[model samples]
Target: MDYSYSEHKQCYVALDCIIFGFDRKDLKLLLIKRNFEPRKGDWSLMGGFLESDESLDEAASRILSSLTGLKDIYLEQLKGFGKVDRDPVARTISVAYYALINLNDHDKNLLPEFGAKWFPIDELPNLIFDHEEMVSLAKARLRHKASNQPVGFELLPDTFTLPELQQLYEAIYETSLDKRNFRRRILSMNVLEKTDKKQKKYSKKGAYLYKFDEDKYSEQKNKNGGTKMMFKPPKV
Candidate 1:
């Protein structure tokens, strides 16, 4: 039983990733200089066309791994862009996903091979196509997520100081945080375990290092009816 579907037009589907990393102080986005035509040599999000046999999540994972040599990364599907002329080469709809990676973990060598570079979120260059809009949307989502949850930990090292953690949040929010209030709020969450080790690089009296207690955090969240831990900024 063959059905004739010649009357309808088909468009290509692509997965575009807004890969974000925090370099201790500033939040950065991973962008590639497109190697192929339609917009060759222009800055674009890391993306690839969805294959027939894979789901959107799988496609996004594959693209990220191929570019960064990373796996099991923190990824979230953002939204879809379906403007008819978004891609001049073809009628295409792109499903955007944003990924957070610890800047210290990814393979630095792989970036050059793909002509990829990291740009600070605040000072991004002109991007090709609808990519700029995708970035804007992803940044908003990231800010909201970070404010309501501990997802920003994905962008930090396993063990970090309170100052480091606060800096990461400040970078994501693009503003200054009141250090005393920030520290007090985060400590009250009781999801961080203080370790004996101290980070001595920055101070005469080293700051204690703390690690996120994921299991404890999960238990607390479950007990609280799955409510997300909030990290709201203090009133100025």
Candidate 2:
């Protein structure tokens, strides 16, 4: 086999994080005000160059931890943005990763150092470079991920109600789902355990609380033949 150096060119690869958190019944994104030149003082995603000694996951963790004092978050590489003119100063390709974290679990002081701020997804301002596109993709991925995987737990408290869970989905999907059907579908999955507790914050009737059933979830995965349910609403 013959190799041609001309067929390939060397370029810098960077990792950008689209850190997502849920709060006040809304979806929010973690954004940093760029402190370096080329786009200094502009809003952008948290990003850094991939170092030679680290794997992609390691580099992502390092970058996020450095900016927000966070580690071990639900991180997954989204995709690579590799247009020749993406970066004005250099030929750099950026691999974006979307991370999920419970708003109550993260450090309260993560914003001071890098000028970080959590902005609601709908109210996001114009971002520098290709970050705006990355944010849009991350939001769509978040909706798909929450539907199929249990990753939404990363954004909720250890204990939650069915309504709380439903609201989380509604916030991400931006639509109201029928309460009865939502509960039926989720309960039918056999992956959630109803608890002895009830939450009364939203109504006087109060709603039963629930937690994820990790063991049954594993078993369900193995079987993969359980009855699938969908929520149906009564006439308004």
Candidate 3:
């Protein structure tokens, strides 16, 4: 190998994260209002230039943790955007990653420092550059994965009611689910363990709270031939 090849141009590599969260009411997106150019003061996904020492995946995780102060999050690479003009200031190619996180879990103190804010998915402000397209692709990827896997649980609290879980599915799929069928299918999987605690915030007679049964989930995965817990929905 030639030790020095100055013939090739070096362009910047960046990672952009489309973080998803659920607030027990609706699905949300975590966006930042960039404080510096090239699109200063515009809404955008959390991003950072790839450092010389880190892999692309490491860069994604670092960008996410810097915003949330949490690690081992559910993150996946969506795709790369390499359009010639995708980035205004440089010949930068961006790898887009999507993350699912519990809404109440992140460090809120960090948001102000980053100018980060949660926007309801439907009400997001205009994003800079190709960031808007990045969100659309990320959402489609999320829906497809969530259709086959219980990854949606990453956006939920430790314990939740059946109603809350149903709402989460509805939020994820963006369609109304038959409440009866939804509950039946979920309980049929037998992956949730009922807890003695009841969530009374909804009413005087609150819905029972349940936590995901890791043991049962593992058994189900084995029974499923290690396909990862199936979260397929009924024909709704």
Candidate 4:
């Protein structure tokens, strides 16, 4: 039963990545300034057209690696954009994915090689086409997941101070969280181990450094039957 009537509609597929990074004080997005056609000299999420021999996930990883020149990043598929007119050039569909990377862990030397620049999430320029919508959705998702899970930790250095962790969340939610409440909640999770090391760069007295204990965190989650461990934020 082979049907050979070539009357089906076909369209191109694209994979776009929203890469998030934290620079101790601000949360940023990694974008590329395009120099080619369609939208020359415009800032947009890094993306590429789907190739013939790859699955959507593989294409996404390839697109991300091509820009970051790294592997095994915290990548999550956000959603798909299939608005018939989303792309002015053609009737194409885009699958969006967001990644979280600790700024300290990434290699800056590769940034220039890929024409990628880190822009503060608040002061971002006008993105090409519907990329602004994609960014908005990603931010909402990040804020939601961060409230209950430690996924926000993916944007911090391996070893950090309590104040540093606070700053990260503050930047993520774009609001001031109660200092005492934030610290108390995070410490109560039992996933952080205080190190003798202190960060004296900002304060003369220095603040104690702490590292995220993955094993403890996992055990606690298992013990709690995978409940939503909330790091509640201050009410606006």
Candidate 4 per-residue lDDT, tens place, 157-213, comes to 888999999999999988887889889989988999999999999989999999989
- Give Cα distance to truth, residue 86, candidate 3, Å: 0.6
lDDT of 2 by residue, 1-236 (tens): 98789868789999999998888488888898888888889999989999999998899999988876778889999999999999999999999999998888787786877899999877997899999999889987777667677788788887898778888877787778888878778788788888888889888989888888878887887687652322322222
List residue ranges in candidate 2 displaced over 4 A: 1-9, 203-205, 225-236
Q: How do all the candidates rank in terms of TM-score, highest first?
A: 1, 4, 3, 2
Per-candidate TM equals: 0.96, 0.88, 0.94, 0.95
Q: Against the true structure, whose lDDT is highest?
A: 1
TM-score of model 4 vs. true structure: 0.95
The Cα local distance difference test for each model comes to: 0.91, 0.83, 0.90, 0.89
Residues 58-149, candidate 3: write the lDDT tens digits.
99999999999989999999999999998879899999999999989999999999999999988999999999999999988888777667
lDDT of 4: 0.89
Count residue pairs with overlapping backbones in model 1.
0
Highest TM-score among the candidates is held by which one? 1
lDDT of residue 37 for candidate 4: 78
Candidate achieving higher TM-score, 1 or 2: 1
Q: After superposition, how far is residue 56 of candidate 4 from its true place, in Å?
A: 1.5
